[model samples]
Target chain A: MDAAAHDTHDAHDEPHLTPYSVYVGIWLALIALTGVTVLASVVDMKHQAIFVALFVATAKSTLVVLYFMHIAFENRVFWWFLLSAIATFVIFVLLTFADYAYR
Target chain B: MSSDTAMPDLPETNYINAEKGLKSWLTTIDHKRIALMYLIAIGGFFVVAMGLGFMMRLELLNPGEQFLDGAAYNRVLTLHGVIMIFLFIIPSIPAVFGNFCLPIMLGANDVSFPRLNLASWYFYIAGAIVALFSVAAGGVDTGWTFYVPYSANTDANVMLPMFAAFLLGWSSILTGLNFIVTTHRLRAPGMGWRQMPLFVWGIYATSWIAVLATPVIGITLVLVLIERYMGIGIFNATMGGDPILFQHLFWIYSHPAVYVMVLPAMAVVSEIVPVFSQKRIFGYRFIAMSSIAIAAIGSLVWAHHMFTSGMADEGRIIFSFLTFFVSVPSAVKVFNWLATMYKGSIKVDPPMLFAFAFIFLFSIGGFTGLLQGALSVDIHLHDTAFIVAHFHYTMFGGTGVMFFGAMYYWWPKMFGRMYNRTMAYVGFAMFFVGFNTLYFPLFIAGLKGMPRRYADYLPEYHSYHALSTVGSWIMVTGILILFANLIWAIKRGKRAERNPWGGATLEWAVASPPATHQFDGPPEVGEPYDYKIPHLGDDESAGSGADEGKA
Candidate 1:
């Protein structure tokens, strides 16, 4: 297979934006998200805080996955995988709450 | 006209020249070579651990401290778990098949990180050496789980082996990352997500779990080491830290860890099921998605393992429900496999035979796990032999059986040689019979109120323990026969055809022991298990599914 076939289908290869812009944007976003996570940790939201911090982290991770990892423009499998992973995390949280609350 | 019809008369693959000595094996980054390394390493550790197992069994032969005292027994048992779980099962699938087939299946020349791939082998060896050092250094008596307080206080060789394990986890994480990136960035043209083979899906799912969950263990282990070496109070109950918190952090990584061990095996089954059935996998999208689902959900249910470890009552209930939720995707995969087999011309090759065994054994393992999932049931059976039996059935019976089966299934394409099928069949029978003999009696021993991790037992449990010990010998003998068969085949086996089993995946489309660059051109993107196409060389007709086998 022509290795060049990959460049044509890459999501970021569109003419509207240069590759430089994409890279810069992704780096900035990652930095901002890391800052947010650190800031959220310092504030004492008590029991509600862990979820808050995780939510922000998850959002940042999504950006990284979508752009940096290139899953956003890739096949439906990546999206399904990310969604499934998040859904499982939700289920875990819900179950933990149920166990702690009921018993 | 086929653009890539002529087979390249490549140099003899390392496989055909199996006796080129250490240099050929070391310099080679072929997946098969790496797989052999894994086979040797895991086999060596299995023997050492099995010896420890026999000593434990011998001590319980007639009960009451016959062979070794409690302290020695505990230390040896801890060493046994450390070796078997970390050294054997955790790396079983990913190292073996993922090393051998991942790049080839994707039609890439090699893994995206080939040097790191070889590095993982070195790290594995290093880890094993460190593990041996720990064993020789008075041995760690803390269970493999290493529940805090005691782990921190114990004078056993905790730091070395635990550090080795931490490095092993890092190696696993890197491999997972490699596979994820490779699968995403490296597939041949036309091998879209829907068209990608299931083994890739299994690895893809497992990679995600490894990347996300492994680091938590890294952090947790650091905390343990800190408490042990630096006298920090992270998990020290006497120092005002909760010991159960360690369990919390531990299972967070450990529980999902079982999936890291098993998902690739599931992937192996997915590949095997469709091939032998002579049918396209039923619900290809669902099966693929379910693997990812299982990976994600599997990680979340780790808390369930800590239920009897003195978590809050509410925590136990929550963990139980999450455990049930996690089972959904696994059940989905099982149902799809059954559906794939329905009304199909299912051939019972050795690999298919093992797939059938995986379904039966894993199902037993899965169902028995539910008993522990229930809050009341676990309280009674938490530390019993029932839990031990259940764990083995899932891991040993589930992944272990599938691992052997996968080796048999992919042996030809990976090694370019076929094993003696009759010997293969005999090996399977011995393993199957011996496995039951070994573990089923443990189930009996478990139900009779026999607790785990103990070297000696009451006289009443003596006969059963003796039976179990004898059965273990049978199991060991079966494994020995398997290795012997594989070794003989490597030396004197018949040359394999490219599509020896009539398998339809891209890996089968290449020459046996494919060239340094795995494929000459883009692989034919097609129905993964299709075998009846008019011209198998034509990529366009490959995925059309029109000529799929008729039942």
Candidate 2:
């Protein structure tokens, strides 16, 4: 495979490289989310503060993963992989919160 | 320990003898050698942990302070759980047998990432050292669960063992990643997912659990560490944390971790059943899908362990339902194995006997598990000897029994030697009797309300304890004999034929113990369980799994 990829020099054989502009855009989005996070912290949302902070953090990470980290151009296999992992984390948080909610 | 050379002129140049010296072993990227390294390390941990269990059983024999003080007993119990669980059982089948067999079965030279495979072995060793260090450093008494306020504030060296678990989780995650990728990328060109052996499917499912679920424990343990060292109060109740939340986080990983311990044993049984029965595996696809189903459903049921930890009733009901659902796939597997054996020319070898034992023992483990999964029943049986007996039935009786079974099943293929068959039977007879005697009494005792993790018991539980302790001695004697026989076979046993079992898998097509490079080049892929391939089923005591290139 290595030899074929090297010798073919075909465009299809090349890895899907994320454009520089896309990474810069992701970086800017991340900075904007961070600014929002900081601003949100200044005002107390009481029960909503943790949720608000988590949402912004998740948004920043998703952008970084999809664009800056190049999962955007990767195979659908990886997309499902990322989704399942996130789902597992969500189920964990949701179920643990079940105890809190009921109590 | 008779070795009447099954194949006297066995090849001198296989994986074990191909490499020499400790340095070669340490640096080698060969998965088979890495497997042997894990076997020796894990085998030692098993014996040590088994001995700790024996001590616990002995202490329970007559009640009040027989030998170990209560504090000492707590430490011993912790060591037994920590060593057996985190160190021994989790890695036993997958790390040892899966490593030795998976790639070869797939007709590949090695796992997708050979270097990472070796690195996983090193990680395992590093974790093991810290675990042993914890034992030496006055041991941890927080029990294996390492729950709240006590685990948070205890001065007993909790840090090292937690650190060990964290490192071992990395080892597990990496190994699982390697297997997943290997199964995806490295299977021989002709071998489709459907054509792959059921054992591969088992490991494939287990690897995902290892990869996805292990880090939950890593994070949970890190939280505990932070709470302990920094006193940030993530879990210690007095310090403004939630202990029940801690249970949630801990079991989120630990429960699925149970599947990590047993799925590979099921996988081994999948392989052993059809081969010994001399029949095509009935419902191969169902068996394969059940492995996946178990992994997926198994992950969701983690909170079942927390049924009594003040979890919401809704969560308990949901988890309980998922727990019952997970049992369906396992029952499906058992049913299929039975179906495969029905009216087949069943030959009883040591491996087959273990498979038979696995079905029976794991059934006990599974049914008992169902009883606990019921919300109402679990409330009654939460931390009794019943839970202890239940897990041991699955883990030891199920996985541990199959671990030896896998040893016998793959003995010729892995080591190029066959142990004394009669001796194996003798050993297993004691093992079966001792295993039953040891744990069945615990079930009765548990029903009568004996608590687990206690050094002493009430006089009412005395007879049960007495019977169980004696059972442990018998069980250990048998286990030791089994181990000794295998060890004796390595040096003096008769040479084994390449395909001694007439297995249809690619591993049997290679020389016993397999060459450093397993296949000459993508040798034949078969219907993995199909016995109808010519000469493949010839073995009523079949030999020569040499390929006809039949699919």
Candidate 3:
């Protein structure tokens, strides 16, 4: 394949570049989520704090994957592959926890 | 067709002759060169580890110490396991063939990240140096798995090996990432995902497992290093940390790692069986999807290794059930291979002989795996020679045999030369016979209650040990003959034709050794395993000619 042709192919399908303001907004949202995680850790509602911290961290990372990593603009297959990897990791953690929970 | 007419004259300039000087190879980003570099490194490690294994077997020839004391034996065993698993088998297929063939098979010029591919090789070398350094500094006694508490408590230089493994894990992750991206982005303009060669699909699946599971082990090893150096309470039982947690984490990567080892071999079999059998691959989609299925399902079955490691009954049952289901995908592959060969005009070349051996030996390995999948039976078989036998059968017999098979199948193309056919067969016979002789007795010895990893055995198990020791000698002799044949053939072997096996894959469409830029232009994409297409005749350059003219 021609080098120019490959570059053109990539450029043709490229998503409209996300505006800098939107990236800044996503960055600010991540910071806010981190603050919430810190707040939850400090003011622990016992076991609920763990859940709150996890939720905020997940939200923060999801935001990073979407806008920061540009995964939001990737093809559907890319999304599925990422989802499957995350699902496999979650299953490993859950299955191990199964033993710990019963014990 | 006469053999003289069938073999085409060698290309005037191929990848090997495209450049000159040692620095060119060191700096070249060509995947083929990198693959050769990997072949040298991986082959070197295999020989070293094989010697260590043979020595260990020699020690077990008697009831007591022969040459190595218990400490020396432990270190040798540890190095053998560590080098074989991390250095040799894990990178064997993907690093060598995958780097060389994947992009060409995809009809592309190179991997998506060429420099990163080079860096992965450097990471491998760096990690290998650290591992060798650890050995020189009074080798670690912890087994390859580096099970916790023992690893943390070992006064030997465990930290270097752990860090070494961590670095090697990064190399694995980078290689996986490179392949994943190259497959997604760099395929020829017309080649669809479904149209890819099954070997590419196999690597694609294995890469995902590499990207996902390797990082867990990398982090686990880092934690182990920290625990040892700083006396952290992670996997140390007395420090209120759970040692079982270490097993869970280590196996989380190591178990799926077995699939990492075998899937590419299976992929090679998938490619070789169809070409040599003169038929289309039976159930191509099924075989491709099964690779993915094995990767996904294989990850879940890691805890099967921990059945007797004080895992809860419920966990054991769940893992056992998952383990049984994991076999389904493997069986699908086996059945498809047999079906592909059922009615076809099969050529029993060296590669095919090894493939057939792979099926037979891998079947035994798989069935024995099922035996251990049974929670009740596994408890009895756990930590015994049976487990050791099962692992070698699947690994050495399955992946190891197929690795040699792939070497035979691709040897001509990689080096533009042919090995002595009679010597090839002689070597194969010795390897197949010696491999069985070496491992099969271990199965019997395990059933007779011989524990593995022991420096000594009881008198009742002495016969089995003696037989196994002799078998190791035979096996090593076979391996030596095989290597010697290939080495001698490199200089003296006949020049090979472009498509010697009449393979339909894109790699065969190029020059025997391939060009530095594999394709002059975009390669013509077609069904990868269609044997009905005439070999090295009319359509050989349908895509190449047009692309060359345009270029």
Candidate 4:
């Protein structure tokens, strides 16, 4: 509770810099995920194809949030904030499916 | 703490007079200025929405259509809900009071993203225009939820209002993001998380709900629009989509939205209850943590709304259980508030009166909600007048009542003028009585099986409807007096003291109506509710010689 406890924030005076190559790498992964999504749609996995496409889209978004949004370089509290959003989403999806699955 | 001299009669340059014209207000990034702008916008919409409610009550006076026909009544109902929920209640406490007070309470000059704060106001205005324009271009009749199948079929201008709801969600998300950053970044030097004010905690939890839950509804509305526009059939049963999915998505965002509406009001109670009682809060951490518990637990109970929509028993029971569980945190709050008042020096001032009213009324609302949460009871009261009555008890009785309370509590500090406390008490009395008279009857009628959303009721229900209509007249008269008294006090009331309420928080430390910059030095952080000894002392920075605990 002292001022010293807050004196050491992870977000210091200097910005956490990411190299250009890391951005290039994330861009390549995004392109590969897009191809996977399109390919999954054309293939006849039927019901699971939607899941496959969704899975790929989720990966793309994770990459964007962690890197493009710089959450990877941010403080621990930032992760807690992200986790809360994910928790809300997971609760909604799971509970919603509980109804649909039971039906 | 030095208390030799009293502070100045009034600050020569406060936020209000610091600048001089229309454009300064229009273009300003100051959180206080933005809050005032939101107050005007939200207040204007509230009156229009109230007028819509008045018309509905007028139409329902004797049943069988007083003036509005069945179709017209449907349109009027939809408009009222749309304006009240989207344009009014959703942003009422947070955007206005939260904006004006949070940064100062945290000992910062402004919100973290001041420009974004201004943008949220503009977004509110834009969405409001679209909603009002929808009314002119042949109003929507989907009844605020915009339930599908029928929503897709309705020829009413659903698209425009739906678009407006989407834009309002953006406004909410941006505001939430701004608040989260502010809370993380801007606490005064020594204040820790536990030492922060309960109002800040309330707003913090609400902001997360806004950020996380709103996007689902935004996309859900968009899908419906696309379904209607392009025959996408996502929610249209004939087109191989599930209408229940639409319900799932709608309430998923909406049920938490109920908390988005009420949590800040609860936070306001946590604040005023202690100051008026002349005691420190009973259990600060418990109250602070319960706000989050309510937010998280409240999010999971969305399916209770869908229980009678023909969902399976497993989902029904689970949602029912969650619904019952959510009330625990709220009950924790109510009990904590009661305990805070015990053996303390209690002042039945207007704000405390409103706080008392909030506890009594919201508890009734909460218990009734638990009644409906029981799967068996819900099967009977699913869409009855009881549901309508329960919602108002919580939203109107809880949030709307506290809105006036906040106006009374902070009026002097915000406007640099003290209102006539006697008139305020009179207004609160009429409002409380008229309020109970108006909505309390519908609970009985609902129990007696009068249906909701209908233009006519059975002859047996006539007495209930009549009494309720008369109650609306009483309530609106009380509301008129309440607003008139406050509005008149802006220029004419007594010049207020900087610390009239002896609050332990930071907002009272500066000049009444406060300077454009809040603190002249690092605000000394203490436990927010502590009132045993003086919480603050005379520093030129703290409006020289204005000491807390003087009252």
Candidate 5:
């Protein structure tokens, strides 16, 4: 039962060159985002600053997850696994807000 | 060819069976051996905790100046809760059955990282030793929750045990990570997600929660310890730290922690229900999804625990409704388990008996939980035995009963031996009867205004307290018998076939006490659970060979 025997149709074998520049650009963008987040947190923006900081953090994490973790290039099955975690986070944070909002 | 005759001869017993001794147990790295060690360690701790419970009951038995000081009783009760929650119940099902079964169920030789698995056991043991030191040194009376200013302010030796708990949580997170990675990467080639047995799903869900939420508790405990020792500015309010922040952080992990405790029990029930009923689960997808839903919803409901802890009125209202919402998924599971049994061929094995008990007891627990979620009701039942009784019914009756059932249910598969069925039934009866007697009265006493964690209670609650103590003894007796039965079965019982319960899961397709490499060949990837699938008896289908390498 050689598993590779069943892998004649490999998904990663698609013709696509994700270039070195793509990685360099992503790193630069991430560094810029972190600077913005830190600057935003310092301004007396109050609760708005907190949300901005979280949003920026989320963006940075997304970039890391997609490129560094290679989740973006992974299979649909892997996406399903990753999305489940995202969905759980959404539910946790939103449902909490639902309480906060209603109250 | 004469090659067969020239083949190297090996010893009769290799590393696994050679020279059985205490040394073999302590230093050995075999997952089964490590799991057995965990079983013994946690079992001993369970006894110690229950003994503490007995002492509490005795003090309550006579009410005033019965056996120990007010502080001593408080300390013992706190230690009992902490030990049972952290040391015993949380790890009981997962570490024991999960370690033993995960590889077998995946049709793999071992966990993806067996050394990590072994390291977890060592971490567990070290944590246990520290916990015992805390207990011996007059114990910390902060309750298992270790609520804010009190925990930080307590002079009783606190930092060491809090550190122990913090380390234990990391150990739990590592174990969770190990399981998640193994279950994902190590399944046999043809084993798909849908093809996985429900117990695996249960563990997978539990692992996810363990990985994500345990960090919060780990940090919380660290903060608490730092506050206690170095006078840190985290949870302590005098240093501009909000005590409410402590409650928030604690429940963030503690609430999800209940799911960690209960999901595996639910998973065990899912596996047992189908086998005992001789039916495929009514809706496998629903059951599996509900586990994920419960884990997700469970994390958000932590605020409900703090409804009366002086959060804003808005926070209270929001948490109250979210609490009810979390109950929806839990109720879905309860209904699904019951529906799985409807019109199916139900067997009355001890495992099923306990699953039935879980359904009843967890329902009581869940409903009582909803009662507490009501801000009005919680204001009254805040520190009462009702809350204590509610959790016991859930954690003890729900998780503990399911754990025992799972042990009996999977014992044959685990040890390749059959336990004495009559003894199993007797143990189940005593446990169920004694369990209801013990906790049900607490619910009554609680509602009638008996606060929990008290060394002395009003005279009116005296008779019920005595009855409860008697009930605890009966429950303890049942556990002793249950332990004996399993031990005897392991050494002396009749050998088991591959699928004693006729389960269609991948685990049952392998050998009883599966070989080092689990599958004879590739997993027979058929329907995971389909009552309609035709079955051949074990004897006729037992000729699969091991040499054919799996992909």
Candidate 6:
């Protein structure tokens, strides 16, 4: 197989080409999520507002990765790798925080 | 020009002869050529850094400074650390050998992005140049770590070196990106993950660490630069910034950066041991997985470096535990390597000797590392000569020795010439003896409470310091001889066979000093370490494949 065919095979067993409308929809969803984050910030959610804002931001980025980046259609290995990267980052942050908090 | 007409016989040109002139090399996108460029550049830096180390050892020969004063000694120490860490060890195995061999090992024509590979080399040179400029314009003495307020307030050319470090980090990240993509996409047909060479697996693990961890240091250095010029208080203690934060950020990358240096060395050992032992690698999957394990667990153990840096008790305890845990994967590798060598047809070639030495020296390094991992022990050993000795044992004995062994192993393949075996053996013996002599005493001195990075020491420490200095001279002599043998071999030695070591790998299938394009067609993937199925260079008896392959 050529490069394109090989890529399709590795990415999705059967290539699934999403419609242009789906991309547009994902873009709109990301925008909506951003707006939600902004709204959460403006409202007096107090300490929970930070969590809400983070949730919306995470949701927005997920939408971007899954749909816009075509990771949704990509192989499962990609998701595992992404998760590992995030986990490693979170571990670093948490460990650093552990030092700072106790100190 | 008829369709059936045989193509005209082109000149038989490998990458070295594929083009002519300095311009060809400068603009060349060929991974092999770029690897050669890096070998030369990185080799030069190694020599300079080695000289700096030699001078430091000379300075330490007596109780007081032999040549350099305190201030001068600090500058030399800083430059040596910076150059060795950034220019020599970090990029030595991966950028040089990885670029040269990864593509060929994968049976691909070149890396996924050839232009990007070339760009990374340029970035490396640019970084080196900036660093050298820093040296010329009054060197920075904040050390390679560039910790906190000293880095911020220093009158030395700190900004340039920091910028240089930033560029080097980018170079590292880009190389990682290119290798990761190449590994994922460019494997030969029928070569699955298991079929991939252990070296590729090693590079794969190292690349991920480089990609994820390097950016932290890049940003940290930028923060330092910002604080220096703009008076930003990111890590400045007086200005409410915590200095420990800098240690956290630096070691986050720099600790994993240890694997980035040594994993490829381990990968080289993984390749050499099986080939020379005349057996398939024992526990191939375990060895492969351990590389990944090292990368992952290695990243989490960065705080171990900050054990004595005033981190909280909880932090020290957690970090010490994690640090001890990281050693498990490394021990797994060491045991597996020993098993691979057990009762096998071990050829005591230069490469195998180095591999054996790596196991020994790296074990010493690892055990000492474990000693330092204990919170209480680390408080005693931290900032001492013992830590210095331990790091050298790990970095120099592990990666640096392996780097030379790789040069010996791949010299024939890379340059198509065989080096003098007598000289190689002599050099290896001297190097091994000199290495132990140089560092072992430092370990003892360190435990005796001799602090490191000092221009002078007390009368009681003089004997150990003298012995260490003598060992440094012997080690340098061995290094010189090794380089001389290889350099002479490149031009004057006997011609080399394609499969000099008689192992099974895709690179060995191709010509020694391979053709510009490594493979004419997709390579036939086989068990990478299948020694029972005799390789091309083996005799007919070995070729008969009567012996059952040992796993």
User: Which candidate has the top score in DockQ?
Assistant: 4
Measured with C-alpha atoms, the lDDT of residue B181 in candidate 3 is 94
Score residue B182 of candidate 4 by CA lDDT: 97
Across A1-103, the per-residue lDDT of candidate 6 in tens digits comes to 9999899778756677999999889888888887887788678988998788778878988888888788888778888878878888899999998799898
lDDT of 6 at B532: 49
In candidate 1 chain B, where is summed lDDT lowest over 10 consecutive residues? B542-551
Q: Candidate 5: which docking quality band?
A: acceptable
**Model 6 agreement with the true structure over B1-551: per-residue lDDT tens digits:** 01122222222566678789999999998898999999999999999999999999999999976889999999999999999999999999999999999998887889999999999999999999999999889997888888887888878879898899989999999999999999999998888999999999999999999999999999999898888888878898888788899999999999999999999999999999988988889999999999999999999999999887888889889989999999998998888888998988899989999999999999999999999998888889999999999999999999999999899999877876788889999999999999999999999999999999899999999999999999998999999999999999887877666667887887776665766776767767788888544445432221111120110
Top-scoring candidate (TM-score): 2
Q: Cα RMSD (Å) between model 1 and the true structure?
A: 6.7
True-contact fraction in model 6 equals: 0.67
Fnat, model 4, is 0.81
DockQ category of candidate 6: medium
Task: Compose the digit string of candidate 4's lDDT tens values, residues B107-146.
Answer: 8889999999999988989999999999999998889999
Clashing pairs in 4: none
Can you write out model 2's per-residue Cα lDDT over B10-79, one digit (the tens) per residue?
A: 5657788887899999999989999999999999999999999998988888979989999999999999
Model 1 ranges off by over 4 Å? A1-103, B1-11, B14-24, B27-32, B534-551
Candidate number that wins on lDDT, 1 or 6: 6
Q: For residue B499, what is the lDDT in candidate 6?
A: 66
> In model 4, how many backbone clashes occur?
0
Q: Candidate 3 lDDT, tens digit per residue, B476-533?
A: 8888889988888778877776677888888887776777876777766777887655
lDDT per residue for candidate 3 within A43-89, as digits (tens), equals: 85998887897898789889989989989988788799789789878
TM-score of each: 0.83, 0.95, 0.94, 0.94, 0.86, 0.90
Higher-lDDT candidate among 1 and 3? 3
Better model by DockQ: candidate 3 vs candidate 5: 3
- Docking quality (DockQ) for each candidate: 0.31, 0.59, 0.59, 0.75, 0.24, 0.62
Q: lDDT of model 3 at residue B212? A: 92
Model 5: residues >4 Å from true position, as ranges?
A1-103, B1-30, B531-536, B539-551
